[model samples]
Target chain A: MTRAEAFSEREVAMCTVARMVENGRTYWAAGGGTPLYSILLGKKLYAPEAQYVTEDGVIAPEPMLPYEPMMTMLAARASYRALAWGTMNTAGIYSQLGYMDYGVLNTLQVDRHGNINSTFLGEWGAGGRRMHGPGGADTIAACCWRTILITDQSKRKFIEKVDFISSPGYLDGSEGARERAGLPRNTGPWRVVTPWAMYDYQDRRLRLMARVPWVTVDEILAECEYKPLLAPEIQVLEPPTEEEVQLLRTELDVRGQTTDAAGGWIVWDGEKYIRGGGD
Target chain B: MTTVSEPATIEVLASGTAPYHKIDPDGFREWVRDNKQRALVPKLMTEKEAVQKFVADGDYITYECNYLTRGPNSLLHEIMRQQKKNLWIAGKFTYVDVGMLVGAGCAGKVDTGFFLCTPSVRQALDAGKLEVYEYSNVIMTMRLEAGAQGIPFIPVRSFGGTDGFNHSGAKLITDPYTGQPTVIIPALNPDVAIIHVQQADKFGNARIFGTGISDVPAALASRKVIVSAEEIIDTEEIRSNPGLTKIPYWCVDAVVEAPFAGYPGTVPGYYASDPAVVMEVFASVLRGAVEPYLEKWVFGVNSHQEMLEKNVGVAKLLDMRKRETIRGGLRA
Candidate 1:
């Protein structure tokens, strides 16, 4: 199959998420996988001046160090501004300093109200599946002007309500819910980007905004546990363009960190797009 | 003012709801008010003395370090060798330090952002021998910041929706001015905080390079701060580079000069991490041979110098240092 034909669900999700990010906005990204790839793709394609800060507060702009040992080593390099703990203690403080404009987070579950869950699934401790703790999701969700959630499309994940709210979205779908919940008036999840479709909050309720070219509104609704409000202008999401695919291959996925269903890393080695390893 | 009831014994809950771990806020307030008048002077000491003098059994201790950088390994080794028991440890993100402590049975409870999935920690948690409390890395820092600022609690926006919010010691309070619900995390105020840095003066004004992580706030939040430095420079050097200083001398109780302190973990401007050794140690931990690994590497060697010479060897150390030169650019 051709490279474009072989575009994986993850790549599509990442590209779609990347397109939503505005250029030159400060972004705080949490969890690896698709969210990290999306931020890197956004920086490479459009958000060149985007200030990217890791959860631990390592701010590095574009022409950034290569991933892997370099990202770890360069994290401690003097050039990376380590905003001392006091200034960047909470996500709210970081947002107040104009550091966090947008956030891309990988949540285990996202509810209709946009509340995210990444902490625990069933019971607390041994009985439950203990996921990674909310690193800065809570803080960022509380203050970032806009937040984007990237997760796989599944009935189990798109639930009526999250098992636990790890990060507040719009609580109870009320007008002043976020303000009442102590979150900044302007801050909340703006987009819920999944492989099958995209969602947004309107009137503090989950609304289907768009769907992948292959999927329909019926399919999207069938996958959600709660009945979702349909957007007035629901559109079909554009597929990954050639340039987007190329950037994802060469710059972002050079290490072949993420893979497709066939267990291959989609790579572009100057001449053409190839699957599996990079040049 | 809400009065927190003092429990007969400190109960460390694995998870569930607010006040997961409790301390009498009134008692803490009285203690802080009394101790605030005490003057602090930096005492130059050995890692052994610093660990022993400040860290007590069942004390809540925080290591001001990140996942794989400036981990205060020397102090951790000393604590391991001494085998201080029932200690509650906290940090932003812990890998080796937490792993070793849990493996050695020194850590009774952990309140941390992130911890490595080591067999020892897993086995302990599964066996119900270890109590674990979770927080996001930034929230951990916020707790420390509140402690440093001498505040009862700080209002935060995050964790309102997570299981951590339900299980945390943080309280949900309405903002009087805005009538908005905000989560308020209580001050941590660890009994002792151990930090490793790039350089420090004899008086303990220390500077760290690379990502400061939560080190500054951790140091400031502790009752006693012990700093281990790769180099002990003159106070004049610290004065010259004032902007780089993360922990001032007033916050420091003791300073120990220990070169190559964060071995295996990199110290930014000084050395690159020895990934091979780190991987080997982790492998050994996963294989349930942590005792042998700790014996040969931690206790069997008398000093960090001996550990470097006998365990890591000069050639491997030299090679790791050489790799840093190529990777040492501000921008790639």
Candidate 2:
């Protein structure tokens, strides 16, 4: 089997997201599964100086190995040796003050305008399925210099218009829409990553920047309800190197907690991935 | 994206017109001055007594920190057990505990920023039994801070562009300094705020070792504060480490010495949350078996200790503490 064939969709997504973490930058560490994995992987692989502040108030948290998602916090019996400890106020102030260079957030849907909706699915106030509401995502997206959104791509997710703007992207894709909407100038959705493809907001519109080698641009576009703005040169996303994959599998997520599946646990079944153990 | 001229006098792009839970800052200040007893007496009480005395029916209540970590699950369970009616909640970054409360008909109005769509919560929302006033997690905490500061409102960099702003009691106002638009959220002074901490004294000088998310603000902002501690140490210990005290005795109304108060959650230096137990509860709720789950966990049990002894057992608690000790490297 080919090297690419061995990797799961979740692994690929994480690796792709890890590459976006710029060195010597501060990031709002995500608390969710894949996004959290991506942040840690990025910190470990390349951005060693990329200080992270958690919503739980741990500043510069150096989490221990065999990472248990929630256990990495101050509450975890394992001491993280965090640089400084404060309340959510400290994190909120830091982000609003432009200390955060990058913010990594997960979302359920992303519209053409880059507005994300993690709160509700379907119509609002009409019995929409409520999801995990914007914990710190609102402040992160609004205040961070740039934000990277990680979500699974589907027609329902990559849609024409999000049901609700949990985190404002480019409000209406209009020029200075974000600023007009009272969001800080020169800060908004920077990049969007998925298992299949990568997107960047060029002219405040979702533009296909790169894709995995297996999936065609047309195939990716077919999955999105609204056709994204195509970049002049679509790049083939590099597959996760053997070293990166091994590090992630062994050191970061040994128990396959984050890489198992997006929402549910899964294991590779040689031909196709299948749910394992059961949710 | 192009740079455009700013709107004149800050037009609110998005806002929610939900009635503020308590907006009279002056009244609040007066009440704090007149009603609050600034004494160093033993404020210790049982969870049942604390919840009953402080958490009144139709009162706007809040739990500090995320329900997953450092959340007052035991106190919340007490409220649910008491079956407090029509309570409004400031569910900040909460999911399970809040869902359980709503499921049990303890709370009807929830001003939540981060709550998961469980079957019961969803059913409540769908059936129009629950009223949700959305706000972001940061905004919710900030609102508490505003109340603590005795401010009528607080300004934030974000909120005008999001749906939460529309569903929350947040408004856009002109920043007099920058002559730009700003999102200002109303101050939230909850009737009662319950916090679970790592340690506290008999006088309610609570010290939270890890991530004091919004506990301080919640404690200071609320009319009545209930602090449940994993270990209640001597007042001398608190006096020796005064800086460690996040919530002082003056702010707290009742201090409940409840060990493993954040069961299914974490208490920082004490123990780690059992996610499997939390997941099992979640799964059970999803399966529409909330009644059985509540009966077994909350209603059936008299106290947190009883629940731990009868259902969770000593072995599980020991195992969790061991895991936490290893994870936190408490000994190391």
Candidate 2 per-residue C-alpha lDDT over A1-279 given as tens digits, one digit per residue, 9 for 90 to 100: 134335667788889988887778888865546666687788888888777877776777777676554455445532377787777777888988889998888888889887888888878787667886887788888888998988876787889999988888888889988777777899988899987799998888889999876668997998899799999999998777666778788877777766776533334456654433311
Chain B TM, every candidate: 0.85, 0.92
Candidate 2 CAPRI assessment class: medium
lDDT of 1 by residue, B143-169 (tens): 888877766777776655456665667
- Chain A TM-score, candidate 1? 0.81
Q: In model 2, which runs have C-alpha deviations exceeding 4 angstroms? A: A1-5, A69-74, A77-79, A254-257, A262-279, B1-15, B326-332
Per-candidate TM-scores read 0.82, 0.92
- DockQ for every model comes to 0.36, 0.59
True contacts kept of 1: 0.47
Q: Give per-residue lDDT, candidate 1, residue A254.
A: 58
The CAPRI quality class of candidate 1 comes to acceptable
Model 2: how far residue B81 lies from native, Å: 0.9
